[model samples]
Target: MKKVFIILLFVAVSAFAANPDDLIGEKFIDVYGKDEKGKIVKLSDVAGKGKPVVVVYWAIGDVDTYKVLPEINKIGKKYKDKIILIAPLLSVSDDKEVKEAKKLLHFDFPVWLAGSDSIKAYSIEKVDVPYILFIDKDGTIRNIMVTARDLKKIEENIKNLIK
Candidate 1:
């Protein structure tokens, strides 16, 4: 029992140490996922480009995802040329599910099917829904918002990142 307790304690510590919040101000890690057309898309492909990238990590049936994605899509449209927006569906593997979710969500942005690998890279395996990462042109994560639904504040962050 003592040995089991020690192992559990170590696992808890490791998980906390790998928190995604620690990624703020750090160089964004490159992760690969499938685009709508089943083509592989790398985070590096969109990020480090000449525009700020907004990565929204969402799931299929999360209420917060449903609530915030439409608003985020508006921002994506408003700054379509100035910013790169990508919504990566966590834990979703099937392409048909992605298409259905995209239609139901009504988000106009690019939706990628982020599998276990991408989710693990982002350290969001146990994190809440609607996890947003704002990456600047240099591929550095500038800001992170977890479970945030405030559209104005989100837009403000995008504008700041653009400038």
Candidate 2:
């Protein structure tokens, strides 16, 4: 019984010490496009008042996103008030491309048009359509999810930070 209690206490202490939610309180930001209708929406101001801000860097023309975006949309809606979900279309080829992609996505989340410089800063070299980054209310970068499965980890991280 003594040995078992010691082991249990050790486990609990380790669990409490290692918090992945430490990703919160870090600072990072990506420049997004504005106009409120295109691939990117530029942030005129920084951070938020109460809720965490989630900005996803995605290119609409990719088919992967077509299947995955709805999942993202679902999560976005679930935490809408708690999170500011913004998906910026990183590939801004032309007006026609932007228009077509928007028609297909029909996403409720705000789609911003981002320039190459902004995209490069994020180191988004791949065509991965569903990259999500969470910036906490105080302007700290909490977490980043580059795929749909990563959403679960991001969600869990958010719950910790929110409370």
For this target, which candidate reaches the highest lDDT against the unseen true structure? 1
Best prediction by TM-score: 1
Please list all clashing residue pairs in model 1, or write none if there are none. none
Candidate 1 wrong stretches, greater than 4 Å: 1-8
> Tens digits of per-residue lDDT for model 1 on 20-86?
7788999998998889898998899889877899999998888888888988888889998889999
Off by over 4 Å in 2: 1-25, 38-41, 44-48, 93-103
lDDT digits (tens) for residues 30-124 of candidate 2: 46575444433455354555667777777755677776666677777888777777767776555666566656666677666766765555556
Q: TM-scores of all models?
A: 0.88, 0.69
